[model samples]
Target: MALSLKLRQGLVSFFLLLLLLPSSFVAIEQAFYTQLLTNAEQKLEVHLYAILSELSMREDKIELTNNALAPDFYRPDSGISAYINDEQRLLWQSDSSLNQQFELPNVELIPGQHLFHLVSQQQNFWVLSIALLFDAGEQTFPLTIHIVQAEQMLLLPHQSFKRTLLQWFIGIGIGLLALSLLAYYWTTAPLTRLDQEIRKLEQGKQEQLNLSYPSELKVIKEDLNLLLANQNRQKQRYRNHLSDLAHALKTPIAVLNTSALSQQPELKEQLDRITAMIEHQLKRASSSGQDIWKKELPVRPLLDKLTGALHKIYRDKACPISIDCPEHIQFRGDETDLMEILGNLLDNACKACQHQVKLTVTDKPFCLIVEDDGPGIAEHKRQQLFNRGTRLDTYKEGHGVGLSIVAELVSSYSATITISDSPLGGARFTLQFPLEQ
Candidate 1:
């Protein structure tokens, strides 16, 4: 459900491209169209001046003294036309306009004034018009010169530029995408390597982070290695203290056992209880519970060894222990913790079953199920079965502390143990371990 850093970066880049590329393309296209209009207006203004210079007055009417203008004025349908008007009357028109039906712009202008804009009719055109005063025998005449060019002329160049611009932008977008992908990989390479190293450490393939890393990650690497060293030292010291305590208590206990008071029935029982409590506490303390890092060990080999030993110990019953563990199934904790859990569960199943016992290992939830074919535990009594001194059977073999130890060990690893009715007609002890992933 959570997104990785690389994927987040890639998504940001993708959305930026989606927003920026089209905006850039539109901005560039609009700018190019404006430039085309400016160029078109300038060209029309030049033709207007050329036509104004060639005009003359004849019989008090405007006329062209000479056809000295751009060749577009002389060529028909050339998309460029010129006209001269006097007070709403057409004085003269260009040869190019003879076959075209373009109406001149109706605009009021004074002498020395000019106007340039676009006009829409059946088709669009750019118009440039200027007003001028003509002199003839002391009479002044106001005349307007008009020059118009079809919008198609500018559109041809505009569309061509758009196609060219689109191609360039598309190429640019693709190149940028490729570079972003390469940058994503380049930036995350160190993180990928560090992740692999951590996984190897978890699997007990490596003891500490040994790979060379960037400055940002080097501090973390050093801190982790130091923590591992400190934990090792602390565990060693704790074990040494427990060993010393055990040895110190051993002498007093031996002397008591040799005394006459310890031989009394009640005193002997009390002494035996004290000895069992000591053994239980020491075993519980020795467990490497819920360590930060854990090793992965295959379950099949250990299961074979436990089942073999249980068979020899309970040879009188000769109850079959059916193991349903895959060869690759693994336990992700201390080997001693796994052995203690499975050993106690299997041994109890063998003792409780009349004929059959079963042990199954599963990976999905990382659970161990031990079942037997004997009288099932009562629901009311099951809740108290794990108490330190609660024994359900009269077999006189165990101190009734195994399940309690199992509960403490399971709780340390953040695991759960449940007792339920088994299909085999006896109690099912289900030990589910926490999955690392």
Candidate 2:
């Protein structure tokens, strides 16, 4: 169960990280690229203004001198070009590659700051055009100076920034995986130990769990310890009750046994019957009381002792009793309780058979089957067998409390008792217990 909980937590964490990491990385990368583009655009606009100012001062020369100060003036990789024109006629071009025809409306040509399109070999360039107007007497000359730069130069830094961002993302992902493993171990270790401690308690080891934990878990540990202490107290109280009940019943049973053996035959017979009934009731009470908190008991030795006692009690009767049980089979029940159940069952089976009786006990899944070779009970009569004092024959010299006691004991433990035909041509009683791991 602890492993299942840890696995569930890890899966949830992994998916959460998967969703958050990408979003965080993209937001950071986009913010960085936006700032880089803004800076690049501002620098480009300043450089274009400076170049346009230089050209405006040289507009008087009909063919501008090639020595106009800027270096690499006509290089394709320079990322800058310029053109000069006046009144629908090109007077001078700074670079022939920059002289391509542009479709611009007349409104876009202003005397100060203006933006216009410049076509260069099928690619469009952004041109900042400024017209210089000089008035000598009554004539005004409109000299348009265009500064052109390719847009690709503005996007170069963004690509480089994205490449660096991808590298950082890979590194962070690996680190997070390593951190997740470390966190899983650190968090789950105490829980694993607690689970093992609980299993030990279930197996009757009865040791206190000692864990070094954080404040959040300290409360849980205290609660578990309190629960364990309460359970131990309850078990001890049950044991004390059984001992007291047994001691209380002992003297009365002794008096009854003594009175049953007195000299008057008729009175002795009546007292003997009452004494047997009292003894049966006492034994049933004692067994039931102890079983209130009984644990698992080894089966073979108890069965051997019980069958041996039965064999000796019926030794004078001319009968053969067979016993078959595995030497190592164990059952979850009280020893005294099972002894009573088996004693009553076998005693009744022996009386019903004339010359042969057989007893067998076998362990099965969640149950035990006890069978005897005797006259099997009829279907209709079996139901009545569980009622107190309901004997099938009045001539039988015993109180009919045996099967009833068995029924009561079985019911107390929430076990089932079923009567069926045995393979030995006799009765079978299958007692089904709750499954234990």
Top candidate by TM-score: 1
**Residue 289 displacement in candidate 2 (angstroms):** 14
lDDT (CA) per prediction = 0.86, 0.67
Residue lDDT tens for model 2, 1-437: 67789889889879977988899889988898677656644654575555554543333554432354355456645766666677877666555344444443243466765554444545555566667674534566787766666555545666787788889988998899789878988888877777777666544465566767667667887987887677567766765776676677677666765773564777666666666666666556555433322344567788778778877878887566676767766666566778877778778777666666766666654455666666778989988999877887544567677788888877766778989998877778787766541
Give one digit per residue, the lDDT tens place, for model 1 in 56-77.
7878666767767889989999
lDDT of 2: 0.67
Count backbone overlaps in model 1. Answer: 0
TM-score of 1: 0.74
Q: Please state the error at residue 428 of candidate 1 in Å.
A: 3.8
Query: Model 2 residue 394 lDDT?
Result: 44
